[model samples]
Target: MSADTPYREELAHALRVVHAASVLTKSVLRSLKNSVSAETKADDSPVTIADFAAQALIISALHAVYPADAFLGEESADQLRKNEGLAERVWQLVQQAQFSDVQQRENAHARLVFPATKEEMLDVIDRGTNAQLKGRVWVMDPVDGTATFMTGNQYAVCLCLLVDGVQQVTAIGCPNLRVNPQNPVNVKVHEELVDESGFGVILSAIRGEGTSVRTMLSDGLGEPCKIEVRSSTGGKEIKDLDLIESALGSTSLSQAEHKAVAEEVGAKWPGTVIWSQQMKYIALTLGATDVMLRLPLDKARYTHVWDHAGGQLLFQEVGGIIQDIDGGSIDFSHGRRILGDNNYGMIATQPGVFEKVNEAVKAVLARRT
Candidate 1:
C-alpha cells in the first residue's frame, strides 16, 4: 500500500472482507444446489443463510478493525433471534467461513477474525443496525442478489465506506462473474458458478483515486489493474448505444418504462438484463454495455442506498456518470433510501451520454402522466 493512496487502509480492509464474504456466499450457493430454503422478509424479498452469514462475517471483520465506525447493512439479526434453527444454521455457516486460499489465511495482512460462538455471531450481525448516517459509516449488502444466488447465477458481495454520507471507498466481489472481459457473461454463468478457478473478480475504488480490478484467486487477489469506461461511443448516435437493465422480475414496471425511454432515445429495446444492480454497474465499467436505467415503478418506490452505494462509486471512479432520472445527482445523504423529489428513477451512462439519456428518460416518462 502506498502512503499517497486515498483511504488506503479502508480500501484494503474492504477488499479483504468482501473476498471472505464472497467465499462464504459461494459455499452457501453450492449447498443450495441440493436444496433451497429461505425466509421472506416483510418487504417480500427472500433471505437465505448466505445473506445472514455473509453479513455477520463482514460486519464482524470490519468491527474488529474499525470499532468506532457505524454500519448500515441490508440484513438484520431480528429474524435469526426469532428462529433458533435459523440462527443455528447461520452460525454454522459463519463458523466454518474463511478465506479459501492457504496464502490468504496465513497472510497477516489479509486474515480476518470470525465470530467464536452463535451468540457472538448474532451480536455481530446486529452491529450493522446502526442508523446514524453521519461520520464514518460502512454500508454493505452481503448478498446483493440473493434471488440470483438461489438460481445459481450472478450476485455480488458489496461494501462501501461513507464519511458524512459521501461514498469514500467501495469494494464489490462478484463470485460468479467471469474475470475475462472478452468473454460473454451469458454463456458461462453455470461454469463460473460451479468452478472457482479464474471465475471471480473484485472491484474497488477510493474517492478521487479511480477504480481498479483484481482476479479473485483461492490464494488471494491477483495484481491490481486500473479500469475505466469505454472512451466514447465511437461517434455512435444516442439510439445506437447499448443499454443494460435489471434482471429481477419485480422490475417489470421499470422494464416497461425502459422500453419507452429506449424507444424515445432511439436506443435498442430489450437491453441486456443482468441479475443485480452492482453487476449492471460492472457491465458498464467492463464495456459489456454502454448504459443502464432504473425507472421507479411509481412515485412511491424508493431505491435502497445499499443496492447502489458501492457500485455507484465504482462506476463514477471509472469515468461513468449516475443521476436521478430527472437529471439531478443521486443523493446518498438521506440515510437508507435514496429519496428524491419524485420516483422517476436512476440513469447511469458512459461519461458523455448522461445528458442525452436523461433527456430522453424525462421525455418518455413525462408522457406517462
Candidate 2:
C-alpha cells in the first residue's frame, strides 16, 4: 500500500499487466498494414480494435490477481457484447496472447491465465465500467491516442492505481516512442512519416519511489531504470521555456491563448505540438520539453481521470508539478472524471518554472474573460 517503499510486488504486477496489454495493442497496430479504420463513439472520438483488446487484456489480468478491485476504463463491454463480430476480434487477440512470454522475459511476478471464451472476455470488459472512487480502484485508458494509434504514430496504454482517491502507482506503455534519448522522435511526427526504429518504451512510477523508464520488448518490458526531471537554470526567461502540446488542435489549450502565454514566457513560438496526453507527459519526464498544457475549448469538456491519473503521477515523481488552471492541485477524489463539474484545465512543468508559467497562464486567461 505504501508508495515510498520499493513496492516491489505491486510494481512488478503492474508492469506485467501493462506490458501484456502493450503487446496486444502492438499486434493490432502491425496488422493494420499501414492503414486502419475506426468506429466513432457516442462522444465523436474514434475507437479501434486495439483499444478494446488492450483494455480487456489489462482488466482481466488485474482482475485475476485482485478480484475485489474495481476498474474504471475508457472502453466498455456493452458494444462488444451486442456485436458478435467485434467480440470475436478482441477474443481472438486475447486467446492468442502469450502471457508466459512476458513473465519469462521480465521475470514479472504476476501471471495471467487467459479466459477460455468470448463470454468471459465480454464479462471482464464490462467489469471495467465500474465508476467508483473508493479504495483500490484502477483507472485505465487502453489507448490514450486512438487517432495517433490508427495513423501508426505515438500512442500510450495508461493505467494508474488509486488508493482512497490518491494516485499511488502509474504504468504506461508507449509502443511507438523511442528508447534512445539521443535520437528523440519528433513530438509531431505523422504516421506515414514515423521512423520504425523508434520501437517502444515503458514508463512507470510509485508515489515515493522514483520513476522508471524501460524499453518495451516483443516478449515483455525491459529492465527498469530510474528517471528524473531536469530543471531550467537562470531566471525564468520566456526564451528559455519550451512547450509540449497536443498535435490534434482541438484536444489542447486554445491555440490563441497558448501563443500569447508562450510569447509572454519567452518560450519558442507555437511550442512543440505532439499527440496523446500520456506521451506529452512522458516527453516532459524525459526532459525532452519544458511545459505541457491542456485548456479545453468548452466548459463541459472534462478531463477524464484515466487520462491523467498515470501521466500526472509519472511527471510528478520525476520532479515535475501538475496543477489545474486555477493553480489548484488535481483532485482525484471525485468519480471517473477529475472534478468534471469544475472543468479547469491542466498545466505541467518543472517546479522551477511552474509559478512563472502559472502567472502567464493566469494573465492570458484573464484577458480572455
Candidate 3:
C-alpha cells in the first residue's frame, strides 16, 4: 500500500467486516423462517434480534483488526442488560453465527475469537451507545428497515467510515434488493427502464473513488462494476424525470408537501413511495428512480445520522447530489443527529436537476408560511 492512500487498507478491512456482517444478518433473517418478531425501543421504533446480532458481529470483527477505530450503531444493549432472558436469547443467536467455511478455512483472521461470555456480548452491544462524535468512528445501522425486513421486503445492512465526522466510505448490503431492474423483486414504481436480473446487491464507495455494485450473496467479494446516476437534468422536464418518496409516514415529513413540490416541478406528481431511505438511495444509483425527496412534517425533528450516512456518501460518489431542502449540505458532525437546525429532511438527484427541485421545494414551502 502506498503512503498517500492510507484509507486503502482500512477500506479493505471495513469491506471484509461489512461483508461478514451482511452474511450474518442474512443468516439470522433466514433463521426466522418468515415469522418476524420485534421489540419496541424507547423511541417507539421496532428492533429485532437480528439487529443486535449484526451490530455485534461487525463491531467485534472490526475491533479485532482495528482496535483504535471507534464504534457507533443503532441497537444498544441497555434493554438486554435489564433482561437476562433477552440477553441469553441474543447470545444464542450470536453463537449460531459462524464465519463461512471458505472464510474459516481460507482466511487466517477467521481464527480470531468472538465474544464468549454474556458480559462480553452485552459490552459489545453497548458500544453503539457511546456519545463521542469526533474521530474515526465506524457508524452502522445493523438493519435499516425493520418493518420491511419483517415483511421479507426491502431492508439494508448499512455501514460507513467517517473521519472527523466527514464520510469517507460507504457500504450497504441489500439482501433482497434486485441488482437488475428487469426482474425487480417488487417494484412499486411507475416505469421500467432496462432489464437485468440478480438478487441481493452490495454497494460500496470511497470518497474520491466512484461507486461500485456487486451481488451480496457472493459474500460481498464479487466482481464490482462501476455505477452512476442516470441523468443530471435537474428535473428540467416533467415527463423525462422519475421520482421517489417516503411510503411510510413520519411526523417529521409531510406527504402533502412532497405532492406540492412534485406538482410545482411538473414532475409526475405522484412519485413512487419507497420504504427505507437506504434502499431509495440504492434505487437512485441504479437508475431505478431519478430523484428522491424527503421533507419533514414539522421543524422540531431531525434526520438521524445512521439513516443517511452510508446512502448519502454512496449517492455523492456516484455523481448524484444530496442535500437539505434548502440546498445546503448535510452536516453529520453533531453527535448522533445531523448537526443542523432545520427539519427539511433531504432532497437528492443528479447534478443538473438538484437546483430545479430545490427551487420547486422553496416555492411550495414558501406558500405554507
Which candidate leads the pack in TM-score? Answer: 1
- Using all chains and alpha carbons, the TM-scores for the candidates as numbered come to 0.90, 0.89, 0.89
Arranged by lDDT, best first? 1, 2, 3
lDDT of each: 0.78, 0.76, 0.73
Identify the superior model by TM-score, candidate 1 or candidate 2.
1
Name the regions of candidate 3 deviating beyond 4 angstroms.
Answer: 1-4, 99-103, 110-113, 180-199, 218-220, 229-236, 248-251, 339-344
Which regions of candidate 1 fall more than 4 Å away from where they truly are? 98-104, 107-110, 181-199, 229-231, 342-344
RMSD from true fold, candidate 2: 3.3
The candidate scoring highest on lDDT is: 1
Q: What are the per-residue Cα lDDT tens digits for candidate 2 across 133-228?
A: 799888999999888788787788999988888889888988777565333322333223343653477888988887888877776666667774
Ranking 1 against 3 by TM-score, winner: 1
Backbone clashes in model 3, listed as residue pairs: 182-196, 234-352, 234-353, 252-296, 252-297, 253-297
